[model samples]
Target: MIKRYSKSMKKRDILVIAPQPFFIERGTPIAIDLLVRNLDNFGYSIDILAMPIGVSPNYDRIKIHRSLNYLNAKELKPGFTLKKIILEVGMVIKFITLMSKCNYRVVHAVEESIFWALLFRPVYKYLLVYDMDSSLVEQMVNRFRWLKSIENRLESIESYVCLKSDAVIAVCNSLADKAAKAGSKNIHLLTDVANLREQANIECKEDLNEISQNNKIALYVGNLEAYQGVTLLYEAARLLQQDKVEICIIIIGGSESDVQYYQNKVNGDGLKNLKFLGSRPVGMLEHYLMQADILLSPRIEGSNTPMKVFNYMASARPIIATDLNTHSQILNNERALLVPPSSVAFVNGIKKIIENEDYAQRLGSAAKEYVFREHGIDQFRRRLQIAYDTLK
Candidate 1:
């Protein structure tokens, strides 16, 4: 473990409390990585307190500290579960302990971590930054129907976190608007950039070769949550199977159990065109996307855009995404084929892309140009620095 409390320090320390495991190749963690790097570049000493569930990467300007282990589990996936609740409690205890020991200029809290920061605000003389990724209250209610009874309580907490924090850093414009409506005094819209370009050099694995050989391959990259529209993808695959147009649907990234569950469904349905490549290295994302004829974002519900969308756009692949606000904000009819959140609409969108090569080429080119022009990593860095400057 890296040293948590150092006696001497030249720069002002910024305490970052991440509710999830740090250094993981997920959306939130990846955003945290870029934030830490940029803050370090601007000369702020960062101390991150995260769950003891991820491998820490080396950062010159930041130190990663994990909470005390309370559960036998070591990995915490995205979304709410019993394991996540236990780990969150452990994180709260560790965060309080760290705040008691160190003097910080700012407290950068992500997701539920803002609640702990709020609790410590009375004693600590530091500015609070709520890194708003999504509405926690909405997420909880959406994930568990049982939690609907206590939604007002969750919303109250969320409102308090947003209103009380010195500033709110939103991942997308939708989140920024939500923060504004919640009475946040200052809101910074810091959108995410693509990581696909950086991951382009990794060599492709052998299992992917067969899928690449197909006449056309459609790729879906993300966790197989109910909200992600995995069922919709399967239904679309089944629909496409009837046509037998040599189009294969390849899914990448899912837990072992999720993969098995979906794999079983595919086998029972006898869908030969659907294949699952259970969780691969995140760095190989561009490698997989490069061989794809079309990329997919079949999310049925959400406000903030998925991190993969930016990479998909950057990949220069024709995208077939739902016509929800989450996707429509970044993608248009010229950049992607937007269909309603239904299997039939999704399949129709895919068919349109497959049948019209000229349309597909133009859409792909426009999408790549759009991402490169608007969502560059340099844009993220500049906006982040500007937000931090306001705190100073």
Candidate 2:
């Protein structure tokens, strides 16, 4: 029989394990914070076991434990062979210890770390919830081609995790379908929506004047990875240079190599309108989004419905994104200008928005209204509650 815990149980505890600690100033950490905060309102207690990702100090919330030691030399490799063995052994030891010491009713694993939680579910008797946000197998193959064999092996491991887990939570329908195909029995689609009301209410708005007076400011947020199509934006900016349509393209985040590669392309090609802002804090991000006339998300084909898309909706900005299945699922054609993944198409989309103010406002208003109603945190909380309640 499946063991269950009551909501009124005096010692009910939920354990969350992720690669980063909760309350950190990053995407996954912020998502965990939202989950914990929402669950707390329902009188559920939480315990967290987190590994540090960036250089920030560990957060101190309810029953949170942070790992002190970094991974050894062998654990830092790209492939899953040696790293998987080490992670499995380490997680099993840590989970066994935690199980012996506490009375956790649920074990929630985020991202690729669900494999570790599945290893201990048999002995611990906890409800294992596998949170699948991104396609690990696709990411491995796309990013690291040399490790194709290792990536294929890791795909089986992910499938095993899904098959063994009691529940699976995905950030989108595409990811949910992938997990279900991999043998996950109970699957829930949980889109990554921003706390729009909170972001809209941010008091700081001084950066509005910083926008270049000569150009129509277009903003792009999120990591500057190759698949994000940052280079395409630069190319589009270059194409619009002599059109007398002054356009300023602002990029938010990317690695050093990514930054350098794009910077060289912009400078070498004399694309003077493009500017790279690197990464910014969340507060500043809201300001940037609010000050912009348009938001651009030229993502290539991938299993990603980026979190930044919600923020774009929250900002009530006319968005020009690529016509991909994942993006089309979240955003309607009426809400955004869904263009083919090409520089010429991107440039035309921007031109359409700039030349027609009423059309842009209509699209932006529809996007904001739709996202606020359908993809807010309240919706996320309801979905999560349903998933948790099913454990009984």
Per-model clash counts, in order, read: 0, 1
Runs with alpha carbons beyond 4 Å of true place in candidate 1: 1-12, 150-153, 205-209
Model 1 residue pairs with clashes = none
The candidate that wins on TM-score is 1
Residue 316 deviation, candidate 2, in Å?
A: 1.8
Off by over 4 Å in 2: 1-12, 21-23, 54-61, 71-96, 147-156, 200-211, 255-261
Displacement of the residue 154 alpha carbon in candidate 2, Å: 5.0
CA shift of 296, model 1, Å? 0.5
Q: Please give, for residues 152-192, the per-residue lDDT of candidate 1 as tens digits.
A: 88877788789999999998888888788889878999888
Each model's lDDT comes to 0.84, 0.74
Measured on C-alpha atoms, candidate 2 has an lDDT of 0.74
